[model samples]
Target chain A: MGALNREQKDMEEQSAKHKVVHYPQKKNKVKRNESLKSNAIAWAFLFPFMLLYVWFMLYPIIQGFFTSLTTGSFGMAREFSGLDNYVRLLSDQAFWQSLWNTVYFVLISTPTIVIFGLILALIVNAKLKGTTFLRSAFFMPYMLSISVMASIWVFILQPYTGFLNAILGQLGVSEEIFWLGNEHLAWISILVATLWWTLGFNMVLFLAGLQDISEEMYEAADIDGASAWAKFWHITLPSLKGVVTLVVILQSVASFKLFGQPWLMTGGGPGDATRPLVQYIYELGFIQWDPGYASAVSYVLFGVMAIFAAIQYKLLVKKEG
Target chain B: MSKKLNIKTVVYVFLILVTLVSALPFYMMIINATRDTKDILMGFTFLPGSALLENYRTMMEYVNIWNGFKNSLIVSVLVTVLSGYFSALTAFGFAVYNFKGKQPLFIFMLLMMMVPGQLGLIGFYELNRFIGTLDTFIPLIVPAIASPFVVFFLRQYLASTLHPSLLEAARIDGAGELKIFHTVALPIMMPAVATMSIFTFIGSWNNYIVPLVVLFSPEKFTVPVLMGFLKGSQVAQNLGSMYIGIAISVVPIMVAFLFFSKYIISSISAGSIKG
Candidate 1:
C-alpha cells in the first residue's frame, strides 16, 4: 500500500523535475547527502520502537510457528516431531469446543453490540435532558478492568445469592436460577457481562459517526416532511457506514480474544462451555506446560483473526474508495 | 400532539431504563461492599450494610492490595509513557522523513496492527524464560513500546496536522532534526499523546491475561491476578472480601472516569474521525 502511494508521488516529483533546468552533479550529490542525514535521524527515532517490536512481538511470532512443530515445552530441548501438535489438535475435543465457543461469542456479540451502540448513540445524541447521565452511565462500565467487571458480574450472577437472581425473583422468577452453575446459563452470564462492559465503547464510536453527519441533510428531510424512520433509513444509516464498519471490525476482533470475563466469571464453565480459545491456550501452555501444543493452537487462532482482519481492511478500503 | 408527546415520553423512559441495567451492577457492588457475606447471601439490599470495615479487614488479610497496587501502577505507568512517546516518535519518523524503505517499513508496521498478541504467547513465555526474565515485569512492560495502533493513529494525526514547511523553517533557524522533533513537533502532538496515554494506562492497568501467564509469584501479581485469587479462594466460603477486592480494583477507574470522562469520550471519537 505504501509503495504504491509513494510511487505516484515519486513519478510526480520526477515529471516536475524534468521540466526544471539541470542541476550540477555536485549539487545533486549534496542533496543526496542531505537525504542521508535525514534518513539517519529518522532511523534514530525509529530504532527503539523497532527493536522492542522485533524482540517481543515479531521474533516470538516466528519462533512460535517453529515451536509448534516440536514436542518441547518451554526452554527445553526439542525433539523434532513435525506436525504432531497440529495432528493432536485435530482430534482435541476441548480445542474444537473452545474454537466454537469463541466463534459463537463473536457472531452473537458483534451485531448486538453494533445495533445497541447505534441505539444508544441516537438516544444520547438527541437533545435530551439526561444526555450526560445517559452517556456516562452507559460508558462507565467499559472503563473498569476485566477482573473488576467480571467480579461485579459474578456477584450479580452467582447461583443462589446472586443479585440478578434476586432481581429476577422480584419480577416473579420464583426458581433460583443457577446463572453461573448451569452450562447454558454460564454462557449467558458471560455474554451479559461482556455486553455491559463493552457496549459503551461501541456507543461512543457510533456517537462519533452519527455526530459527524451534517445536520443539513436532516433539515432537508424535515422540510420534505420525512418521517423519523425514513430520515434514519435514508440519511442516518447511510451516513454511518464508515463507523459501522469500524465498530464491527474492532468489536469482532476484540470479542475473538475473549478470555478474562468468562475465565473469571464461571471459571470457563459449567464444564468447558464458556472457555475461549485464548484461555485454552493459556491453560495448555502455563497449566499443562505444553508450550509446543499451545503454540499450535495459538497459530490456528491467529489465522482466524487474520482472515477477519483482512476482510475488515477490504471493507474499510472499499468505504475509502 | 398528545400522541407525539406520549411517544417522546416513552423513548425517554426506555433510555433511562436501559441506563439502569448498566448502572445497577455498579450500585449493587458499592452497596454490597458494605454488607457481610451472610447479608449478601440473603438477598440484594437497597441500603448499605455495616460490614464495610470488616470486609476491608478481611480483604487485607487475604490479598496484598498494596503490593498489587504498586506493581500495577509501575507496569501501567511505564507502559503508557514508553508506548505514548516512542509511538509518536515512530509516527513522526514516518510522517516527516523521506528515507529509503520508509514506506514499506511503515506499511509493515501497519500490518502488524492486525496480528493478535496472543498468537505469540507461548513463544514469548519461552523466549522470556530463555533470557531469564520469566517472572519479572520486563516481559509485561517492554513489549508495549511498539504499540502499532497508537503509531497508526498518530501517523494519521501527524499527516494532517504536520506540514513539511515547519521542518524547513526549523532547519533554517539552525535546529537539528532531533531538536526539531522535540521542540517543534512534540508539543503539536501532545494532545494526541495525552489521549493515547489515558487509553494505554487504562488498558495496562486492567490487563489480566499477560500478567497471569508471565508472572507466577503471588507477590508480583497485579490487581486482576490478585482479584482472581481472591475470587477462587473466598467466593464460595465468604464473598465479603471478594466484594471489597472488586471495589478496590474498580473504584479508582470509576473515579478517574468521573473526573476526566469528557476528555476520554472526546478522545475516543477523535482518533476514529478524520480531523
Candidate 2:
C-alpha cells in the first residue's frame, strides 16, 4: 500500500515537472551568483548569534557530557570514572521507578491528548458560532506558566478543602479522595493537570491538519451520500495520518521528559508514584548531590528517547520513500 | 439538513464542555483568591467573595510577589531578546550560507533541541560553579541565548518566506553583507522574530529547574521559584494565598496572549503545520 502511494506521488511529480519544463523561459531569467553573494551577506549578519551559540549552548552541552563522567560534587568535579555512572544507574531502584512513571505518563497522556485533540479539532473545524472564541478559550490554559498550572491544580486538589473534592461532596459522594496525597492517585492528578495544560497545543496542530484537507474531498464524500461518521473515518482519518504520527511522536517524547508538572504538582510525592525519570535524575544530581548516579539515569532517559526518535525517523523516511 | 444540524449541535456541545473544563479551574482559582481560606476549605464558593484584599495582602507579605515578578521579568526579557536574536542569526546561517560542516552543525542543533534540558542539570551546575555564576541570573539568561527551537523555527520561516532575489538586489545596490542583513534581512524576518520572542519569553518566564538549581537567594528567585516557595511556606500553605500567587503568575502571560493572540496563534499553527 505504501509503495503504491509512492508510485502515484512520483507520477504526479513527473507530470508537474513536464508542465514546468514547458514554461522554461520564466525559470531561466533568474540570476544565481548575485543571489549567492546576497546570501553570504545574510550569513555574515548571523555570525554573532552563531558565536554566542557556540559559547553558551554548544560548549556547555559538550562540557556537560564530560562532567557527567567525573566523580565529585557539582563544584569539586575533576576525576573520571569512565562508565561507572552508567553501571551504577543499572541497579538504582529509584531510576527504574522514575522510568516506569515516565512510560506510564506517555502511555496514558499521549493517547488521551491525541484523541481529545482530534475530537476538538473536528468540532472547531465545523465552523460553529463563536468558534474563534472557543478556540482561544480552549488554548488559554496553555499560556499559563507551568508554575501557575501546578499552584492552581494544587489548590483544586487540596484533600478535604479543595474545590474538586468539595464539589464531589456537594454531589453527595461520601469518600473524600486525597488526590495528590495517595501513591496511585498522585500520578493521575499530575496526568490530569498535564492533559488540561497541553491538550490545546495538540488540538491546534490537529485543527491545522484538518484545514489542510482539500474541500473537494468532503464535497466528493457528500455527493457519494456518505454519512458524517463515514466521511470522518475514511477521509479525515486518512488525511490526518501524517499529522497524527507527528503529534504522537512529539507528545511521546515530551511526556517522557515529564518533570515540571510532576515536580510542581506532587513533588513526586506519596512515595514516588509521580516521579518520572528526568525528575529522578534531577533529584539525584541536584537534591541528593549525586552527579555520577544522576548522569547514569539521564543517560538511560536519553537512550529511551533516542530509541523512540529513531523509530519515528525510520517511519518518516519509509513513508517518504 | 437534520444530520448537519445534529453534528453542529454535538460539536458545539462538546467544544463548550471541554472549554468549560479548561477554563473552570482558572475561574475557580480566581474565585478562591477572592474568598478567605476558611471558606475555601469549607466548600466550593461559586460566587465572588470579599476576601480579595486580605488575600492579596497576605500573598504580598509572604512571597514578596512583586520582587519575584521583577526578577522573572528581568530574566525573561534578557533571555528572550538575546536568545531570539542569536537563534535568528544561527537560523539565517543555516538557511542562507554554504559554509563547511553546516549540515553537521545543523544536525547538532536539532539534536540539542530534542535532548531534555534536565539531562544537563548536573553538568551545567558544575560548570556554572566553576565559572562562578551560581546563584545569579546570568546562568538563567546566558544558556537560553542558544535556543534550538527558535533557531529551527526561524530557519523554516526564512526558507519559506524570504525571496532570494531581494538579497541579490540589495547586494547589487553595493550594500555590505552586514549592512544588507541589518537593513534588509532583519526587517523581513520581523514576523518570525516576534513569534519566537513570545515563545522564548514564555519558556524563560516559566523556567523552574534552572532557577531552582542555580538561584539560592530569595531576591533572585523567579516567579516559579517563588511559587514553589509559597507552596512550601507556612503562611502560603493556605489555599487562598497559593491561588493568588497562581493568579499573579498567570496574569502577565494571559495579558500578553490577549494582546498578541492572533499573531501568536497563527505563528504557532504555521510552525506546527510545517513540522
For chain B alone, what TM-score does every candidate structure achieve against the true structure?
A: 0.96, 0.92
Question: Over the stretch A14-127, how does candidate 1's per-residue lDDT look in tens digits?
Answer: 423422422224258876686677679879988998899899999999999999998966667897889999999999999999999998999888888898889889989999
What is the TM-score of candidate 2?
0.90
User: Over the stretch B6-30, how does candidate 2's per-residue lDDT look in tens digits?
Assistant: 9677766776788789889978988
> Where in model 1 is the C-alpha error above 4 Å?
A1-27, A313-320
The lDDT per prediction is 0.83, 0.77
Candidate 2 segments exceeding 4 Å error: A1-46, B1-7
Clashing pairs in 2: none
lDDT of 2 by residue, A1-321 (tens): 232244335433543443343333434435344445545655675667666666665565566677667777665636898887777767878777888889888889988889988888787777568877777877888877777788788878878877788888989998989999998788778878988888877888888888888999999999999988899999999888877876887798889878888888888887887888888877888788877777767767878888878887787645755
On lDDT, the candidate that comes out on top is 1
